[model samples]
Target: MTSDKAHNLWHQTCAEQIAAPVLSGDVTVDLVVIGGGYTGCSAALHAAQLGASVCLLEADEIGHGGSGRNVGLANAGLWLPPAEIRKHLGDGPGDRLVNLLSDAPRLVFDLIARHGIACEAVQNGTLHCAHSPSGLKDLQVRHTQLKTSGAPVMLLDADEAAARTGSAAFHGALFDPRAGTIQPLGYVRGLARAAMQAQALVHQHSPVLRLSHGAGMWQVETSAGSVRAKSLIQATNAYHRNLSSTAPEYVPVHYFQCATDPLPEELRATILPEGEGCWDTGLIMTSFRMDQMGRLIIGAMGDLDHLASSIHRAWVRRKLIELYPELQDVPLRQGWHGRIAMTSDHIPKITAIGPNAYAAHGYSGRGIGPGTVFGKGMAEALLSGNDISLPMPAIEAHHERMTGARQMFFETGATLTHLIKARF
Candidate 1:
């Protein structure tokens, strides 16, 4: 059921966007990365560029996970604000990550340019729309932090927000010139292609069933074959197949998106006229963006593929109309969901599971930039045999995984809220 839901909508739309071939036969390498999403591909690209023999394995095609289904926002930072991050990770490590990713959009766009990646890369900017007065207050705080950190950002009044987003649902907005959008699937595929061109071996349809550490190397066993590498990186993030005991502990949060049939040119001209990706400032956050073909895609908190599919569908319809009253008749052509491996703290982590072996995941819905940044950092760390390869200092391990009633409590609460919202 989960797999079906993953492939039914936007996933189907992205079928031909990736580059080729699944892993077969056995080969050895300096590094073996499991999971070929943004992180794995980036790790391969960076590792190989640094003169390391690299092999990346993907269970499905490249971009089969959240990397493809993403809303395409190349945001600069994580979900946490600078102050909150500093509070949690201390001024040193938190500020380091902040500094690294503050320039992440530049790195992303630069890579796209250098590779001539065909992803529809747009760098105009991104808007964080305020859903309420409280939301605006939060943005104001963020605005201050961003400015203090020398980010190119601007605060927009409600009128300006409405002009930019073509909606009055937001009270205000904070615009970050450093952020942008892309054809997400294309970007991941392009990364894989570039890595391959750089002599990194990437194979799809290769699922690692087990990982064992011995003989001064990590052995990854797959149905088709096996690989032995000096180091291993678990880049599976959310779509992991639970193939090993070293799986990262995380809360599985689901985010779904529905895409409208291409709007008429007139409607497209009004909605996201500046061609910026926009997301809201609510606890249950929402995102909206127009694709190159003018499909107005809107996404929110709950998984559309869950048992509450009807409720999620209803909310999509109503939310569309509420956001753009004039588009009341816009037909939603596709709907899909992907799991986000969210840590209790909503940050990505690098965990040293064993000697010379590590696992990385828990992006908490902020992937693209962080994924690339972290992947490259992981590669450098492995190559250099030092912990300093990461932008943020690596944590030995995250807090104990949320379990039992706690997990169900979150799922039930989210489902209940989604149902309630749809009903009203």
Candidate 2:
């Protein structure tokens, strides 16, 4: 089946009710934010709370994009480990960003608590499972790096890993006590609601058609009207619109997920009993987590709804059987897929298009915490009229290939690789 079914399940359960009108007439604000996902809502909330007149525009309903459709893992730091970050950005710049993100989970959970947003917030922890013996070595190094940086992390041996995950497929796991999970779509919607409550104007179904800067102000033109502001922030990330000249070049990657019906009471106690989110060590990563309702949501690399539907279905079934023989007969209740914007270096970017205009994207599938942190930083920078808040200093923007033919090529490549692995 297509992801439409899974999409509906997520939307119905996660999205909170909110009545946001579309932009009707030309308006002026201290700042205008494009994209109404977590980052955009976060920017609007922070800016509005800081006494900046803010207006946010969304192409669709709040949480309709990746923010709402995500796997709901609220993890600190980026996909890159701390040592690799230091290697890529050097000690000073890398350490600053790492330090900022290390505390991001705290900020996220705290914000949820402070705002009283009901998104099934949980901070139990997260586990990075090692799929192979060699993967355990990598996890060991990462554990060491995290410890050196003073992060609250633990290394689980094979026995402990199996016990915690309820599967012997993983050799070990790197447990980060700071990480957690939630209902992703609900969280994004909550952010929008919070921003609205704080007096920020959030418009749904208002995609920016054009953006121009002149006369010492940034003007964002929407379908219904125009917004003039002293500063503009692009928080679209993966769901970015073509309203600006500087299109960022990124590899368009897709990830798919499947969720089983809620487990029986007897089984729920042994499966992810502590309620930790988990992802494996494979290059083509896989994630698994249980919802508050006891449904098992399993995500993998290939795009099932987008391409290779049968293969993806087969893989999920095979994977579940391999991990837990008891779950081999469990039927899948939901299946969905979402696109990811990935840079060649696997790091997100904050690019500057003009004076007082900044755009950030490329989350590389790590969105929740980084998105919120980046949004908060971007809002601070725009409010204070400074660009120093960005983790990596903003750079110029460029366009990328998202053509149908290219997407087909990628799908074919992934299919072939998976088929080859199955054959071997």
Candidate 3:
């Protein structure tokens, strides 16, 4: 679904374009990985390095899914509050997952550095802006929790927040120095290239039509060929295409982003000068950041390509004016949207689909870091025949209730909000 205006911002600024051969003949390997997004690429890279003969397949080009079209925040932890996570998974496992994800930024940055990935990686930090008084209060609570958990997060005062954001719109903010941003598509593609260097075979346009297991091996069938392996990893995330295997069930959430052309030099100096990505605390999150080329990218939760697109776009224009009056009438270079696989409980799931096979999904909009960590963990787990080093315990069954209805509800809610807000 390549619209001229969809997901083109990243492509225009991409430092590298990577692709692999389409499946031409049947091949046998120690591991078969489905999907070529962040998780699949990372898993294939790690597994191959760990002495496994790995072959990865993608339905489209590498990172053509959510992995390529994300907000590029590289945020740590799930969208759920820390206490809520503890409430869901209990104390020990909850703390363990949090602790593991806390290091997501480092893992991602390290990979970029080690592999010399050309993605524009920024490590300064990120800002969770308080969109309202209540939003500030939410940040305060999050700040306390993060501090108690040994994180060096700072709660910036209103004045400081204004100074950093270059706008006086926010009440305050929680600054996490550990978090950062990246060129997502570039990063994912680089992972694929690195995997290839490590002796992993990656095939593009190889959609898995059937997946079946028998006689101690998993057979994954595609159009032109098939892969038979001792183990399998389904890392498709939100872009799962069904075959004989069941994709991870989730409530789909749409997030749309609009990138403005590079700001003038004088305007750029006053806006996000220190280069920290930002997101608000509103239930319908609004995010803003400047890319390496000084283009301002703003985003929110909604379908920006279809039914509610006009309203969403109009609202965004209003939002830009409200956030920065100087930016009134500024042209939006391009707009795009991506799907997020959100779990009801806001936790990522590593479900065991069958013997020696796993499906990991439900990042709830936090994918880059967790995806990498999960990929590394899933690869090791496949080899060891257990999830010993994985952050979260693998469940045997993962089923979501009313996924279709919930997805519709989110879209409708976002549409109505955009429609109403645009008028207001």
Query: Compared with the true structure, what per-residue lDDT tens digits does model 1 show for residues 1-424?
Result: 2334444344544433545566667888999999888889899999999999999999987888999777889999988888888888899998998888888889889989998888888998999999999999999999999888888899999999999999988999999988999888878888998999999988898888888889898888888888989998889888888575777778877777888888999998889899999999977778999887889988887765567667777877888888899998888877777778888777788888777767788889889999998889989998999978777776677764545455566556666666666333
**C-alpha RMSD in Å of predicted model 2 compared with the true structure:** 2.2
Candidate 2 residue spans exceeding 4 A from truth: 5-8, 398-413, 417-424
Question: What are the RMSD figures for all models against the true structure?
Answer: 2.1, 2.2, 1.5
Candidate 3: tens digits of C-alpha lDDT, residues 329-392: 6788788878999998889999888888888999999999999999999999999877787778
> What TM value does model 3 have?
0.97
Candidate 2 per-residue lDDT over residues 147-234, each given as its tens digit: 9999989999999999999988889999998999989888888899999999999999998888889999988887778999998888
- Give the Cα lDDT of each candidate: 0.83, 0.83, 0.88
TM-score to true structure, per model: 0.94, 0.95, 0.97
| Number of backbone collisions per candidate | 1, 1, 0
User: What residue pairs are clashing in model 1?
Assistant: 22-204
Candidate 1: deviation at residue 115, Å? Answer: 1.0
**Best candidate, TM-score-wise?**
3
Output the better candidate (2/3) by lDDT: 3
